[model samples]
Target chain A: MPNEAVQYLLTSQRDDGGWGPYPTLPSRTESTALAALALRLAADVEVGARASATSGARWLTETQLDSGAWALGDGVPGPNWSTTLATLALTHFEGEDGAAAAGGAWVLGARGQGPNLWSRALGLFLRPSDTVELDPDLKGWPWVQGTASWVEPTSYALLSLKRLRLVGPAADTRAHIDEAERMLLDRQCDDGGWNYGNSRVFGDVLTSYPDTTSLALLALADRRGEPAVTAALEALPGLAADNDSTLAMGLVAVALATLGGDPEPIRARLRNQLSTWDGGDIRGLAWAAIGLLDGSDPLGLLDG
Target chain B: MVSRRRFLQAGAGAVAATSMACRGRPDPWTPEAAKKPANSPVAILGAPDYDETRLVEVVRQGLGICGISARNLRVVLKPNLVEFDPQGVINTHPTLVAAAIEAFRLEGAREVVVAEGSGHRRDSQYLLTASGLQEQLDDMGAHYVDLNHDRVRRTVLKSSFTDLGELYLPETVLDADLFVSMPKLKTHHWAGATLSMKNLFGIVPGAVYGWPKNPLHWAGIDGSIIDINAALSGRRFNIIDGIVGMEGNGPIQGVAKQVGVLVFGEDPVAVDATGARLMSIDPWKLRYLEATDAFLGNVGEDRIEARGESLSSFRANFDVVTAFEETKVEPSTGGAGGPARIDK
Candidate 1:
């Protein structure tokens, strides 16, 4: 990571020890998690980086709900998708196992709502065009409890589960991971990448987005040999290049590096892009750090 | 005999009221008050295309006709910037947004900010760049707020159309003195038509509610629209972009349909009703507008005073999906006879 970008993330921590998407915004779980992860990645060489990560981790633990989930913050709903992000950040710290495990448990129990019997009947008899071609009963993570599953949240949840070492030896956690993996595979667009959720909507095939596609690829890194994963890997560079977004490009670099693809070209493009980048988007900056900096996979997705 | 559409709509309303009662929250307005709403003026002005100079004058004229007050008020313009479509059918055109900002400034507004919590895209920077809104805002020296990441305040719903009792809305929306909803006049596969009222869904923070605001969809799209609009009842205005709209499957993935008119009104229900009418749709048949008619604004034609260009002059047929065929008002059958479908 560039010294200036590292310094910016370090100095921008709020009094509550969290980071917002940008300065002047209230701190949020997702933003703070991204910042903390970036700082943890920088800890090896940058001074004060470890301390900042610890403080951000402390805020995350402090704000965790009694039900073992983290919300976006005040006024936002609880036990939502950010719990995965918070849990992932907590895994980096020592003595934070209890909080992180509790989060993992909550995530394990959380399930996205699918078609009920009544709705299934309606779809079969009346509303055929409204239904997408996916297993209605296949459960995955949702942005909120009782809502439909989406690609980004499900991918993040899988990444969090993997980081917590919950997936192994064909246990219950492994079963859940397998189900979510299937869900992600089912949601992949015909273009070989994933959309926000549905691959096809109302008979029209939805196109893939670089950001969601990258996250999905990162979550499914272990299955890189699978046809879907291979196809998406082949499509990532072009999509990222076309998007011209720091967030998308950075995520693409991270996914490629983690999946053992040739990330050097995308990283080179990302370097040029970040040099002239002037936006104050913290996620974009944090992603640039995670992708550009020398590091083992920060979230431990590659760890056994 | 009541049609199947009316029966379903009535059933939905009853369920909402029953749920509200079960939750111990009395509705602020009675159904009788909803039925006898005072007449509101909706102005429809003709504009051929997105010529910035011509749109500025037309917007000013429409604002005047709708009786907008902008002196020293902090205005927030929430235009539909949902996704990028090369045909330019998916979002409200940037020229219209720039025109609205200029017209508001000419009307003596203190400040105008363009805000939208994009329902589909998480990356606001990408959406802005892809839609050309960033360039427009930069050129006009306007501020833009990504409401998804903005500070929020929990607000209790004034009306209970959904079981979601309250929503954490962005402070930028709630604090604005004049909150203007600039929606692309288009057909939604689920909602029949997404107008100024339906556009209010963007104000609900995705940071809180998540992308696409699925809770709103799950609670029911029509009811959520009523709930959000009711929450912000008094401090709202509408400017429907019908100059070049969308038809068939929309809110996204639809073809462009040009109507050559802009619809404006203080009452969102009336403005949306006029917008629906311009697309040859029956507003009375739409569930949200029907419920909104009971209290929020006038969807009834007799209760809306037409201003500027006549409604019939700019009437254009908008093709809808197979499901929404009933939503269209047939040229020969132009009365209160169209059927409405409830999206589950």
Candidate 2:
């Protein structure tokens, strides 16, 4: 994928103080959520670099709805997906109670009542033995073949909640997590994985890839069931390192690190993979850093 | 014993799994790491003679006292192969390696492999070939494997004492029934001293880690030699070629001295400590020794019983190149970076 495209899909702001669609067009939930995240990342980078960190924050604050929810524009704001990202984004502005708590509450609510998004985004928030509450975080979901519900937004929400040690309605939470895990597992093509939207409700059909498998593994690791764990292990080997997306490689490292007992082999693979990266991939680095520091299995436990 | 057969059947793989069970150390796969314990002690020997013909004999006696049989054992002898002036006394001498090889064969060693990993930027094989040990290896029907590129690898290294992550070791050396460390006596800039244990830095792989074969060097923990040796659980031996010593900026570029004393031991640390004492330096101040002492739970003279030559009996000129002062003017070799900025 184009670096610009991934950046656009991930950024939290647009030039006009509005959020953009995942990659291109400006939309309500994604654009707002993305803009919020961009603001936080920008602020962090600037703090370390001693550059301006508030431009992104300013954009986020300007875009927040009166209900303390963030939106792409002035629309009825209740979509929890946008709010979850917004909450996470605002998590950076901890000093501003009005904005920070608004964002945190949205995250907590969505985590408690929203869909499961624990795999791809907001993963840094998760820890072992965590359950979070999430409120519905999006509205007017977009899809190509069918109507959308909690799959996409819920995945992001679950990750957000998992990070903060909050997840709930144990039965429903398990069910949503289970369905996503199964669709991903059951959709494994000949080579042992779903391509695009197989695991993701809005999975990447155009990118039938191991990166998607990588995401599924992260989710499965957190969702945790004997079958899910087993299926994940089976699917892990199917991931090709030379694929279009290295995202899978990193996630595979995480899952293997978690499931495998002797980490020497896996650690070797991780070092080999990490050293090869161009070092500009912040998202990839985030996961790589976690793998290096701590993973589903605390990395310190293994000595080769 | 739960079926001696089954316990033995669960090979290094089981031990690898156990190594996986500990944490709190650096990932050894990377060049930098935390100091760790070798789990088992290697024999350390002090010598009454630094004579060329008697060097290997003293080493053998040290191993014998420590209960490691040099006879009929597949052995890999590793030495420092850093690129430096031969006359500089900064490098391991060819004759020292030759002595060990001949003695091992005489003792009925099944086969011998003389291996070394030189400067990460230089080929280790070239150093050995240049030092003329390759010829010695061939003469004895022994083989030479450059630790830098050889593909022998196995993982089961778990330091029971530190958080250093699971690490991999060269398969040839790891598989050998007897591993012998043969390092020239020298003082270091980082580890503060180069002894039998410090010489083990050559065991690191440049193929996997690239240049700067040691990760602890990068992590600001230069005493990696101590941790790496401490973590070694395999049956190994230590032999110091102190007949001629290199002091100041050692293990690479240093000044040559006629310390004229050979030290040997079952414990890499103990032998190294004795080497330092013979040089009239305190072993406690050494980076590797300090790190080893912390990991081993104590640092005292009582734990060590010296044999062969007393520390006072051996003396050498330690006025050699300092490790940090040791710099090379790369020869005018041309490559991808164009003409080498060669200094004479």
DockQ of each: 0.51, 0.01
Index of the highest-DockQ prediction: 1
Q: How well is each residue in A201-240 modelled by candidate 1, as lDDT tens digits?
A: 7888899998999999999997989888999999888777
- Candidate 1 lDDT, B155-190, residue by residue in tens: 888766666788888889999999999999999877
Q: lDDT per residue, candidate 2, A1-304, as tens digits?
A: 1122223223424455544332233334444444344334333322221122244456667766666666433333333345555554444444544664555455443322222221212221132112112112322111111122223333344443333332111222444444444444544444445343322221112223444455445444554456655654666564443332234444456556666623344445556654544322233333333343333453111210
Most TM-score-accurate candidate: 1
How high is the CA lDDT of each candidate model? 0.81, 0.47
What C-alpha lDDT, on a 0 to 100 scale, does residue A21 get in candidate 1? 83
Off by over 4 Å in 1: A1-4, A75-77, A116-130, A166-171, A276-279, A295-298, B1-37, B331-344
Per-residue accuracy of model 2 over B169-207 as CA lDDT, tens digit each:
566677778888888888764455677777877776543
lDDT of 1 at B23: 72
**TM-score of the B chain in model 1?**
0.90
